[model samples]
Structure formats: C-alpha cells, structure tokens
Target: MRRPLRILQATALALCLLTTAAPASASAASSPAPSPPSAAEAGPVLAVPADLAAEEVSFRGGGGLAMRGTVLSPAKAPVEGGPGRPGIVLVHGSGAGVSRTKLREEAVAFARQGLSVLIYDKRSEGYSLFRRSYPQLADDALGAVAALRSRPGVDPAGVGIWGFSEGGWVAPIAASRSADIAFVVLVGANGMPPLRQQTWAVAAGLRKAGVSGSLVERAEPAMYRLIADGGLFPEPYHDPGPTLAAVRQPVLGVWGVHDLLTPPAENPPLVARALEKGGNRRYTFHFFPGADHAAHLSPDGGVTRLPELAPGYADLVGSWVRDVTAGRTPVAGTSGPAPVQDSATVPMGPAARWESAPVQLAALVLFAVAFAAYPLVALVRRLRGRSRRPVTRAARLLAATGAAAVLGLFCYLFYVLTTGAKLAAPGPVAAGRPLIWLALQVLAVTCVAATVLTASAWYRSRGSADPARPGERGERVRLGLLLAGGAVFVPWALYWGLLLP
Candidate 1:
C-alpha cells in the first residue's frame, strides 16, 4: 500500500516542480576614407583649422521627426549669388547619444577645405540597442542632405554623404534610394552581415586581449548566432550586398590597416565587386596605417584610440569629394598598403527552427528540473520521514556536477559576451582557456564519468531492490532523473564546445 502511495507522492511532487521550473527562463562618427598618399609615403598630419563658421540649424528627419544640427562652412561666407561650394552631409554611426558635436572635428576639417558640412543629432525615435531601421536612418540622412543643399552657399548638385562605421551601412542605402546624393564616402565599412561583423569583431578583440583556444575558434561565434536567433541582437542578419549593388553614385571606401571592427583586407574587394556588379566603376579604396576603425590614430594595431585623425585622412576626403563632385570620379582603383587580418571570419547562418529561442528555453527548463529532482526528492523524503533507498555517492556527484556545469557555462558565456568578450575581464587564462572555462570543462567531464558510475551503481542496486518495499520505486525514479540529466549534458557540452578539442 505504502509503495504505491509513495510512488504517487513522488510523481505528484515531480509534476509540481516540473510545472514551475518550465516557465523560468527569460561606432565612432567621423573621419572616413581615402589617403593623400600610401601610408608609408604619408606626409605630416594636417591640422584641423578652427577658421570655420558653424550655424545652428534644424530640419525634418525620418518619421516626421524634427532633427537639429549645425552647418560648418568657410568662416568667410560665400558672396551672395556667387557659385556655391560643394556640400557633404555627415551621417552618424549607430548609437543614441551621437550628436553633431561628436563629428564637429571632422566637419571642421571638411569645412576648412571650402566645403559645406552638415552634422546632426542622430534620431532617437526609431533607434536603440535592440531596434533600428536603416532605411529610416537613410531618410534622416536625406533630410540633412536637403537642409545642406538648400543653403545659398552650397551646391545642391554637388551634395554627397559621408558615413563612418555604422553609418557605412546607412549611407549606401541612402545613396541607392536618392538620386540627389552625388557621391558616397564610407570609412571602416563592413561588407558582411551585421552578425558576422560583430562576431568577428568580438573575436578579434578577444585575440587582441591575449585570449585564444576554442573561445575564439568556436564558442564565441556559436554564442552570437544563438543570441541572434533569440532576437536579442538588432539587425543581426542585415546583408549589405543588395544595398551596395543598388548604389549608383561614386564611392570612396576607406579603412585603417589596423582596423579591428571591420575586416579591412576582406571588405574593400567585396565593396568594389558589388559596385562593379551594378555597372558602376567610379570607386576608389584606400588604407591608412596606424589608424583604428574610425580612421583615428591607433599606434598599436587598433587596440587604442587617439583623439587625432590618422595622418592625411581628412585631406584625402576633402580632395576626393571635390574631385568626384566635379565629375573627376576615378574609374576604379585601390591604394595604400595591404590590410592585416589575424584570422578568417567564421561562417554564420541562421539557427535552425528546432534550435530557436522557445526550443532552447524548453531544453534549459528540462535539464534544470531533471537534475534538481534528485537532491530535491531526497530532501522531501527526509523531511516527511519516508523511508527510501539510499542514494549512491555516484548518483549524488552526477546530479550536483551536471547542474553546476550547465549553469556555469550559461552564466560565463553571458558575462563574456555582454561585457564585450575580453573587454569586460574574462578572469585568468591558462593554455589559452579562461580559468572559469577550464573549470567548467572539468565539471563536464566529471558529469560524464559520474553518469557512467551512477548507472553502474543503479544496475547493481536494481537486483537488490524489493518492489514491495515502500520507498524502492521512488528512489529508482530519482536516480532515473539524474541519469536522464547526464544523457542530455553530453550533447549540450559538445554543442557549446565543452567536450571539443
């Protein structure tokens, strides 16, 4: 009688806890493009002169939102009715607080070359960490273009757009949609999808910080894909291929030879190919040595940033824009030294439907419940004074280690990614693996071994079990859960690089 009753109570307790556990899971703006000369032959850094006139202005941007900005032009205003100067509207990179001020130095540099420059506050309405509309950003750029073109001192027909970093994606889209934009200037632009670029960037940062092993080779990219599949990453799969193909205007794409964010060696050829595919050949590519992603000075291969723009960067843009806007567009050419890439980009595709967010959440809940049931069932029997078969030491080790390994991997990965890979401080590393990661791998192995020993113990005890004993069935059920958790742990560990070499 007590045997059946104990079975019923344990089953009911498992159901209640299972039900409860299931629901528990929840860019720099500015200096971009072109060089006065090859990096080795580069001349003195051109000083940004302050002899520019900046006027406060406002314009209507995308989504009918009012945007405010400043127009930096020659200190000596153009004579009334005189031929207007060429114009360039600066589109900001991705971020909420990026304002006109952020690009003021670049604008001042452009204005000093006798061009009209418009730098505006990026729209906050339809932009954020998890949300953004590139088309909408392009519209806002067109708005700035219109505002700058309307000024009496600017040449409406000569107006073009300059985009850096995130703006690289937005600028081409704007140029593709608007015939009014005369030429396009991109700095530190990415030709791949946002997800791939991000994954590469994080991995590069990790490597730069002295991290190696599977962290860079495998887990880093895999985690990014998983995050993207869960919809937490904004525009993770946004492809620049079609947008670049649609651009009809002349393009000047530039990158720092030391750029860490975008793959300099890889992007230029891709951008050039895309432009040529669309029957447009007025493109020029340049690389700047000792420059970071933003074309800013970075002496240490893009690991650190300096306030000054790379030598000759602004002068190159000023000259290139003037030439292209004046119908002197280059047929097609690449200049400067070759870029250095420490590693090849990892291929990333969309996660399968079976591996999507909801399914992942369900898996987590199942693993948690199954492993937890062992110790929990033991505690319940002890409190209720219910006699139960003794849980072998192997089964106890399996339950504790399996649960710890899964939870540790999840938490550690989250910490590494959220804090920008190695930037947020990924403890100490030994033999290229973080200390915490090494510990988790050990736990994963322990789980596997414990699973085997626990199974052996269970087999030996099954022969000794009395079906008629009150607590016999309940003890077997608990052991079964621990074994089930171990079964799932092996594949989970392998998937996340735990069991990988």
Candidate 2:
C-alpha cells in the first residue's frame, strides 16, 4: 500500500543518554497503536505492483495464538502446485503492540520489488495471552515462514526473514532452528548481551546529555553488578555471538553510524566476526553513516523524519534481497570504499563477568550498609536512652546530611528506572514538562557537605573531655565509619552522573 511511514514509541531503546523527546500521550507509548483495525478483510488496500495482489490472512502463531498476517502475492503467478516466487517475512522490533496498519507500507514496498512479503501482528496481539519471550517470538517468525510457504505464490525454497532491533536477536535464532531458512537480514542487530547493551546505552545516553565523562566511567562496576546479580533478564543475558555464529544461511546485517539503540561501532564488527566463524561466506554486512536506528537521521534532532527513507537505504535493502533471490553476487551496499569510521568508537564486549562480580557485590553491599549508618546510629541512641547532647549545629546538620544522602541515593536509582526506564527523562514531568535534572545535584551536594561535616565531627570528637552516650572510643569509631560511608557516597554519586563537579 502507498501510505505514510510513521512510528511513535519510547526511545529509551536509544543506546545512550537519558534523553528522549517525549511522545504525545500514554496511549501512544511504544506499544502498538491502540484499537488497530482488525484482520477484517481478505485483501490489501494499498497500492502494489500491478501484477501483485494483497490480502489479510491469519495463522497459528507461537503457542497456537491466532496471529494476524498480511500477505502480498504476485497477481500473475506460476501454475498451481508448482514452485512459486521467493518470499520474505518482515519481523518487527520490540514494539509489543505492532499491528498490520503499521506494517502495510513496508510489506507493499518489498512486494513491489517482486517478492512475496508476509507482515504479521506480533504474538502479543491476538492469541496466547502470555508475556512476550524470545523463544515465542522466534517461533512466531518461524510460523510466518510456514504460513507463507502455505500460500499459492510463495516459494518454500527461497524464503527468508528480515528483522530490526529486537528482531535482530529473534531473526538469527529463527534462521538457526531450521535449514529451511534460505537467508536473513538483520537491521541494527545487537552483538552484545541484551542487558549489557541496554545498560551501556543508558550510560552512553547519560554521557551524551551533558553528564561528566568521569561520572559515567565510575558507574560501570555497579551497572555490571546489576546484570550479574540477576533480575536484569528473564535468563542470564543472551550472548548473540553464539547464536549468530550458528546461522548457516545467507545473511545481510544493516546498521547506521548514529544508531544509539544499536551502536554501529560495535554491532557491525561483532556480526562480521560471528558470520565469518560460522563459515557463512554468503553473509554481507553494510554500515551507513549519519543514520539513526532506522537507517535515517532527523536533521533537527527531532523524530520528524524526511519523507523518504535514508539515502541509499531502501534501495540497499530491496536490491540486496532481489540479488539474493536471483542467484547473483549481492552488492557490497556502497559504490566506493566504506565511509571512514569514528575514532572514538567502542567495541562490544562482556560488561560484567564472574571475576568482577564479587568485587562489585562487596562494594554495593558496603554502600548499602553505609546508607544505613545514619539510621543505625539513631537507633543506638534511642535504645540506650541517651539524653540529648550538646553536639555542634554543624555536627547535627552533617549527620542529617549523611542520612539524606543515603536516602537520596536510593531515590536516585529508583528515579532512573521509573522515569528513564519506563517513561521519558529521569526527572519529574509536570504539565507534560520534564522537570530539570535536580535529583542527582541534590545527592551530590549532600555527599560533599556530609563528607566535610563527618570529618569535622571526627576531629572534634577525638579531643572531647566528656563524650556523651557512646563515650570517646565508641564515638570515634562511629564517626570514622560515617566518614568512610560519606567517602563511598562521593563516588557512587559521581557514578550516577549526578554532580559532575
């Protein structure tokens, strides 16, 4: 169908920086467009090649869920019961609510190029009211392949899958499951473990949005620990290298230089190495400069896109697929030598490992304990029934500051996950406005002030003739631990990209 190409969803998937231009409404969030048109009719309404026809179809998806699929076919076809034309199945990214309406243009685009295209609603849509899992989504794509093969104009021997973003991970496994998969196209595929990629992207986004490099650097160990300590993924992070290495089909990996969601610096190399090791000489990898995750960039830095797909991108994908089906050597995806790569590019590697996990665990634990120091001291005083002592106003303020910093640290982590992870920025949004970043600043100031006061308290306590409840020795030890906790808070604050100074 000739239609507009537009997708509005959460950009938290953008690799780095905690920034995203917020969407219009909660209804328009990354989930599929709400109240999508049903698989109502049996025919497509969009314009396609004069010799092709379009129709809405449904098939059994993963777990026997009823999935809605749109099939585009050649109007003039080989005789019935004969082998048909090469087919391509378009798999969606992480959009759980992806619908037929959102995919008609893409399906028509490929069909116009003389290939049968099957665009289907993801498993999250119709049947199997279960939470989405990779195994199931891969099964859904495989099911689409089966559904396509069942069609009159689809060639079973020439069928393949093309996926983007999360699809990058799903498509490979679908291809690996059966040798029947003739080829694969991965758009912005991820090379590292899924969670690591996500965390790195979060950190990278923070660094891009005015966060200090030093703070970003210091946060890695704790971020790494978040992964190894579990709760990050349904399973241990999925290392895509092994799965990509197992694919024997002809493959094409497409990426963009400016794709924050999938770092172009890393994904291209990782896919190249894995495909090479798998002995898949049929694999071709292409990188486009100045494009975002979708192979196009917004000049004004807003999501408003150019009417056309990125320069040479649509042609690159269409032409490559045609070549694959035609038994010709696929184009290298560029006329001249590749564009020069960025010098600051970072590669994809394991983020947290067993060796590092222990140290991170200890640091995180002590920090949490340190976070409790203020409370612990108060509780001690309460139980001992100590009368109020004449501590300096500076000491009282400093102690309270220490407690507040601890509380702020806990609040800060929650803030990142709640705001950045689920919503837009890591700040409160009022009247659709993202409040300025102040949480980190508050924590940082508190940490600095706490450090000085704790030290000063320690200095004065050491020389006191009459120590209060804890006495000199006990008071000295408590003060020292408080100082140590404050010291740890400084780095932890920096790690969150809080106060850079």
Candidate 3:
C-alpha cells in the first residue's frame, strides 16, 4: 500500500515537474548546435589520451530514435590473430534517464582500464513515455552493442554489457535475445522478481524511516498490489532466472553488503543459483563492505561532495572485462576474497508483476465511490429543499466519527507517499517531519474511537428499529454511509500499519 501510493504520488509529482521542465527540454533540444566534440572539449580522461580514443557517436533505436553517447576505446590497436580488445556497453540504471553526461565517470573509468565502453543517453530522456517499453529499451541497448562491436579496436566476440540497478533487469533479457552478447556484469542488481523487489524496497524504506518491521511485513502485500496498478516503472514480467540461465557466457555479480537501495544482500545469491542451475559454469560474485546504492559511500556515511563514484568500483568491472577477454577464466573479484556463497539451486516461479493490480484497483474504486456518496446525497437534499433527517443522536455520532476516521487515514496515506522517502534519510523521525507524525498519531487514536463508536451505534440502532420512521430513507442512507465508510477505513488503517505500535 505504501509503495503503490508512493508511486502514484510520485507520478503526479513527475507530471507536475514535466510541465515546468517542458520548455527547458524543448529549448535545449531545438537550440543545440554545438560543434562536434574535439579532443580538448572532451573531459580530461576522455581527451585524446596516449592509451585511449574517444568518439562522439549515435545509433538508431526502435523507430529510429537517435540515441547518442561517446564510445571510448584503447588507443592500442587490436593485435591480428589475438583476441579482439574486449568491449562493453553501459546500460542505464533507473536514473539513467537523466542524460548521457551522467555516465561520463563510468565510461571514462572503463576506458582507462583498457576496455571499449559505450555510454549512451537513455531513450526515456527524449522519447515518448509510452514508447519506452522493455523491448524498446533492450533494442536501444542492442543498438549500442552493435555500435561498440563495430568500433575500431573492439573485439566483436568479447563485447557485452555492464548494467546497474534497473539496467540489471534490462541487460540480461537483451543478452538472452541474441548470442552476440559475450558476458554480463550486473552491479547493484536485484535478483528478486521485479514486483517483489520493488515491494521489498518500499518496505525497507519504511523501516528505515522508523516504521516497525512487523508493520512493514503486514503492509507489503497491499503495497505490492498498489504498485501493480500504477507504479513508475511498468513492472515487466521478466523472470531473470531463465534468462540468467540461458546466458552461456561467464557472469560477474557485484554487490555492496550494506546496500539498501537495491538490497544487494539477497540478490547476489539468487543470481548465482539461477545461473548455475541453467548450466552456466563460470560465475563470480563480489561483495563490498561499506557502500550504498551507486556504490558510493563516506567514512561515516555523512553527505559527500560531487563525483562520489565508488573508489575501485569501476576498476573491478574493468578488470573483469580484461580477464575474460584475455582468455583467462573469470576470477571471483579484482582483489577480494572468493564469493561467500558457492552455487546452489534457485526455485523458479512466475514473476509478481501486476498480479494484484486489478484487485487493488477494485478496492480503490470502492473507496472512491463510498467516499463520494454522502456529499452527493447531501447536495441533492439541499437543492431539493428536503427537510433534515430526524436520526437518533447515536447514528449521527457514528456518521461523524466514521467520516473523521476515513479522513485521517486518507491524509496519512497522502502524507507518507509524498514526503516519507526524502524525510527518512538523515535519521529518526524528527519534529519537522513532513508527515506530521503527530497527526498520524492522532489519526490512529481517532480511528480506533470511530471503530468502537460505529460498532456500538450499529448494535444499538438494531434494537431501536422503527419501521414507521419518518426519516427512514435519509436515516438508512446515513447509516449505510457510516457502515460503508467504516468498511473502507478500517482495512486501510490496518493495511497501512497505522494501528500498530
């Protein structure tokens, strides 16, 4: 429930942001007439170095979208009859939608390590949102693959992809689609099914914000369903297992032991199991002790300055490319201990993508209709000049209490979805917390009171039933409203873990 609500609120936020950003985006695209990049214009490392060559390049994606990036290759020409210089295309992470320049650090570092690397702008940056489907993203990646393989010194047989975060999911599927891909490097990848991974991510986030573990567990499924309907990323039905198994190439998995962004702790083992089960013999997994998502960290995790790209992170990946392409067997790490978990069997099952979207949408519809009924009825009565109902005081209180309770729960949901993630970062829930934890604390109390009050009214009204009642229609409507609102509010309250300690 929390995750889905977060996504919904976030989508609304993105649309709002896009409206403001549209003009800037248009201006940038239309006004762009910069000269082609020269050696000096390229950054320090990317400049024409003695050992490296950088080229401004572009490739046609699905529907001929011109995705652009820089391809960096070793200046040393490939030796004839020797293994072609190994190469890799950089697959974008979730935020890869930012811009091509966002990947400069990774590209330059890999280029320095002596591998041909392609870092391209993600299609999502300029393409229509609806057109950026899984296959289309994969197609864009494959386009880069083709471009990289065609590079002057790149070995067509040794070129593959290095994917981070969501790219992890996209890269494997792209690789399995063709034998052209030689190997895969998955960094900060989640081995969990997409939906499960997202749900777990939301749950962990809540826990970090001081949400209790038990409540997080309770709220996870409802949140999963919410995500199914309208989450940011269209949940793909990609089961990474079969695809991971299908890859005949040696694979390397990198993770940070303390990573919460993608929860690397769980996924590395999952990746290994599936690969081994699928008959993939050469697999290497490495864990870093003190890194977060994006593989960046500080000595004590305080906020750091720009270019916090993890030390030696890119080098590890670059080294893997060096070893695999040099005809040496894949090593566990560039210089770390062997993989903690050896190969094992991973249970294969259907992905949780959209499994609960329909039912969750049904619940939202029910709540919406029920929430609107009373106000619409009151407006009609006012316009028609109907007299006020002579309902008993108890029934009126029930209606009031129920409405208040529903209002509280709805507000809390809105608050969490809007501000929880940002506010959760520094530490414990603070006084200036956006959710107004006190309001939620008050909401929890009022909801309990409403539940008790409504139940009491319901029981007492039955005993006082009068078939000849004058305000029978209005009274019945109000009673139904109270019951309906309570029905919606109670479960929502419970699902959000609002009633928990």
Please report the candidate that would top lDDT against the real structure. Answer: 1
C-alpha lDDT of all candidate models, in order: 0.78, 0.61, 0.61
Cα shift from native, residue 452, model 2 (Å): 5.7
User: Candidate 3's residue-wise lDDT over 1-501, tens digit each?
Assistant: 656556554544443342222211232445544443453454444354566777877676654556677788777777877766788998887642556667777777787887888887776534343223556677888888997888776789999888888788888888888788888988878776665665555555565566653234544445434534554335434577887877777788777555555655468767877877887767787766555555665443312313655677777888877787777887333334322221122222332443354444445555445545655665687898975643344434444444554445444443444333212332244442324444554555564565566566666766676768766655576667555665666665666665654
Q: Which of candidates 1 and 2 reaches a greater lDDT?
A: 1
Query: Residue 387 CA error for candidate 1 (Å)?
Result: 6.8
- How high is each candidate's TM-score? 0.87, 0.70, 0.75
- For candidate 2, write residues 1-501 as lDDT tens digits: 011101001111222233322222233224443333355743455455567787776676666655677788767676778667788888887655566656565566667666788888665442221124677788889988988877777788889998888888889989989787888988778877665666566555554444434333444335434433433333236778888889888788777655665556666777877877886667777766566666655453322344445567666667887677668755333232243323233333444453243434444455555556655666788798863453444445545655655445444443454343111254443332224435445646866786786577656655655656346566556556656766776665665455553
TM-score of 3: 0.75
Task: Report the error of model 2 at residue 437, Å.
Answer: 7.2
Best by TM-score: 1
Superposition error at 49 for model 3 (Å):
7.0
Candidate closer to the true structure by lDDT (higher is better), 1 or 3: 1
RMSD of each candidate relative to the true structure: 10.3, 9.4, 6.5
